[model samples]
Target: MREFLIIGSKAKTDKFSLNDLPGAGRIDILCRCVSSAFFLSHDIRRDVNVYLLLLGPPDPPKVIKIVGREVKYMPPDERGIAGLIRKALEVKADESWKKSSPGIYVAKKGLEELLDETASDVYYLREDGEDVRDFETKDGLFVLGDHKGVPRELEEIILSKAKKIIGIPTKSLMAEHCITILHYELDRKQLNS
Candidate 1:
């Protein structure tokens, strides 16, 4: 299975106004990334996993996990998506990785902890990194940062843990677009393999 780790530098870890998915001026981007990761040609693909690291108010950091086939309450728009994530965060704060609902898990863990737990080959997506097409592709986790980009400290952690840094050929693309392109490339590789 393929996995994605999206770092929401300002995404809230508490309940948010559904009407304003941009609860912290960046939650909307997280929603879009989730949508792209879960969507397939006709349905949600089962082989993908998305992890969102929220670092906003109420709670500084929280990890939200979405497993495609297991997610029972997917939202069609950014608002609903944000709501689902907020709901996940509503769970009691004592647990580190508690399942708030089907296919969704909330934890106090941050990006570094999640990456260590995943134990998958990690790839950091960067604009100046090696071209994805030329690099060896495998089933693993892809790490990306939101609009403002990953914080310097976090970027350092990612660089230390990542097996490689991947780059798309074009200018920097949106986080969601990068996922879609990576999926297509990986899919093509699987077909030919």
Candidate 2:
């Protein structure tokens, strides 16, 4: 069934982020960092602990989920890191957890926070704007959510991407907790083995 949130809808993927989450990891690695950026050659390299990030066509935008935050939107460049300034959280965030990795965190509450953001940025790319820009690459002048306020259709796609990568998070893997949807998948994979 399709699960719809207050302002969004979730088309159940065949799977979710079990690949890049705790349940599926060979081992677990977790961390506690809000968000960070490395000095890349051009713009800043901001890495949001996003559960999902999607960039679609026509108009380009992004949807991302960060630690303690819910789904939110941002404008990213074609080849740069995510650009997320702030967001209006849809749910209460969970900041309490074991430190693990950048943007990735562990919390007692599973998906407790829901931000209105995303890492999937899409724009016309044919056009440009103030604060709205894209990077020209060999592929094309692809647009990104270089700013904030991404849309929902793109968010779903990112969530869909998270569905594919399979593995346990490096740190902060929850050995004892309510079995998340992710855990169920990991269990099945183990059983198949």
Candidate 3:
């Protein structure tokens, strides 16, 4: 399975209106990342799982997990995806994950805590990192930061824990674009094998 952990450095942690995703600390970006991570031309990619770490005002850290294999009633558009996030934020969550919707869970864990619990190899995505094309094919927990980018302290921690720092052939790509390219590369490698 392909697992992704997208950090929303400024994404709001409270319920937000559908019309103001951008205003909600760019929750719109996270919504698009979710769409790119699992949705194809018609069907959802069941092999994929997405985690959103929201760190914004009123709430510093809230984790949202979307399991494609079990997710239901999720739409492909940003507004639809944001709706799910809004719902999740409305519920109370703690260190343990709480089911907010089908295949979607919310928790109050930071990046370090989540990484400590993850069993798979972790790949940190960065523009200046090693090219992903040269990396071996494997299922991994890929880490990405939203438009604001990973903070300096967090970057250091990720760099220390990640199995490898990898990137696509391009520079400064959007978080969603990076996810799409990663999936494409993985799909290509799987087909060739």
Candidate 4:
């Protein structure tokens, strides 16, 4: 596995609206509010590299989503949401950067802090348009993304890892969430790896 990207978030407003968008194969997961069955759902795209942006304050120790009958948890705090989203956007703005860096990316910085030490290594990218910080953690490496969703660059690695979790052939996409990988070489490599 390239790495494990566990995104713990409370507000997934953007992810919920993805079905309304013109696309396919998003994360194929859902982020839900605590104590609620409501969730943000998107299918893993076969073409574009996409992320679900949460539109709300960051909070943790809460239920974020129910992906495939599994419960995904959040940090219980969202104070860092603004900063995380910005960095996520920066990653999305440039997929060319992925060939160089690879790791997990998420939408909230607070979530990074909440990840149990079990997380061996993580790549945390946080941006605010005012600043873009990319971090690599060889041991317990974690990053906090605020506004923008997981960048395409980092998504490359997450997509690779996702296959290990779900064991299904995944589709690839561009930074804009458009189906870009017709022959999905990246997905192929991820599956093979």
- Show model 1 residue runs off by greater than 4 Å: none
lDDT of each: 0.85, 0.24, 0.91, 0.27
Clashes of 3: 0
Go through the candidates in order and give the clash count of each: 0, 58, 0, 44
Quality of model 1 by C-alpha lDDT: 0.85
**Which portions of model 4 show Cα errors greater than 4 Å?**
1-65, 69-109, 117-120, 125-186, 191-193
Top candidate when judged by lDDT against the true structure: 3
Whole-model lDDT, model 3: 0.91
TM-scores of the models, in the order given? 0.95, 0.19, 0.97, 0.26
Which pairs of residues collide in model 1? none
**Cα error, candidate 4, residue 49 (Å):** 16
Residues 42-128, candidate 3, lDDT per residue (tens digit)? 899998889999999787799999998899999999999999999998889899999989999999999999888887889999998
TM-score of model 4 vs. true structure: 0.26
Stronger candidate by lDDT (1 vs 4)? 1
Model 1: per-residue lDDT, tens digit, 37-142? 8887668878889999988886878889998778886865788788788788789764377887789988888777788898579999999889989877768899
Estimate the TM-score for candidate 1.
Answer: 0.95
Q: After superposition, which runs of candidate 2 have C-alpha atoms over 4 Å from their true positions?
A: 1-37, 40-99, 106-126, 131-152, 155-193
What C-alpha lDDT, on a 0 to 100 scale, does residue 65 get in candidate 3?
95
lDDT of 4 by residue, 10-107 (tens): 34322223332112112222211111111223332211122233324322222121122221232212222222332333343221222112222432
lDDT of 2 at 183: 28
User: How far off is residue 98 in model 1, in Å?
Assistant: 1.2
Better of 2 and 3 by TM-score: 3
